[model samples]
Target: MNKHNAEYYISKLGLLPHPEGGYYKRTFQSEEQTSDQELSVEFEGKRRLYTSIYFLLGSDDVSHFHRLKSDELWYYHAGSPLTVHVIDEHGVYKEYKLGIDLENGEVPQVLVPKNSIFGSSVKDEDTFSLVGCMVSPGFEFQDFELFTQDELLAKYPQHQDIIMKLAYDLIPV
Candidate 1:
């Protein structure tokens, strides 16, 4: 197989434009569901135990800051490395490089805990990245929240630069 660009993955994988940015296609939803009694009070009904998607980001694309009710695990698939910026529930900020490079501190998989604000971008300007994300307790539209610039800045005043960069709308030309 030959290396391809973001457009290739988007078309081949049948990815759609994602609200938080990037292109993605849900690839899995487990038949098993968490029992209502075992579920968090925030959940109104039973939910699939797990879900997964193929996510792609081009050099110019940015996965805006967003949060989910369930923890999300990211697995690197191909293309260039991606930088995932995260602000934990405690307000601590961190960056994780997602790729196959272990010598340079890149990790093939990373976990973003529930309710942690996060975003991502292709590490190299001319490249793209393809990754897989798995969310436990499944992924429901109701469980997702995209952060607004003002709202996020209010909560994380110290991360203004990055917040502004990732929070702005990316109107495609």
Candidate 2:
């Protein structure tokens, strides 16, 4: 186990509380812009080629189910493995474990395709998982959509357990 706790990494990395959950710090934002023609009309204008952030999720916290217009790739960095749950466009539920334990079936990288609703959690108590997420065509607040438990249940009642665990009734500011 890592001797450093969640607080240690938060302080060391200068992470701030993320609206979704846990802590994060934007690490990179590409200066290059993507051609507006390459993206959907909802993009409005050209966006940075890509953006990256360091995301940390603690045992008791969950990254709420949210949708992004762009695809994201998660790379495990430290601590225990984390599980990323996703509901695809077709309403299929899937899970990806991110960690270095290849023998245990944990992958070093997990991809959340565009238009997928996804969230993540660390399963072990007193432990946290750190990862880096890279988003293509960058990430814009206008393209992010957060859902409430009730809202998601209406669309995906079959995922009641996960929705109840990850979706929030009220998001804290």
Please give the CA lDDT of all the candidate structures.
Answer: 0.90, 0.91
Top model by lDDT, which number?
2
Candidate 2, 1-173: lDDT as tens digits:
33568888898889999889999999999998987788764687889989999999999899999999999999999898999999999889999999999999999999999999999999678899999999997988888888899999999999999999889887655
Candidate 2 global lDDT: 0.91
What lDDT score goes with residue 125 in model 2? 88
How far residue 71's Cα lies from its native spot in candidate 2, in Å, is: 0.3
Each candidate structure's TM-score, on Cα atoms with residue i matched to residue i, is 0.93, 0.94
- In angstroms, give how far residue 127 of model 1 lies from its true place: 1.5
Positional deviation of 70 in candidate 1, in angstroms? 0.2
Badly placed stretches (over 4 Å) of model 1 are 169-173
Model 1 agreement with the true structure over 1-173: per-residue lDDT tens digits:
34477777888889999988889999999999886689764777888999999999988989999889899999999999999999999999999999999999999999999989999989998789999999998999998888788888888999998999888643333
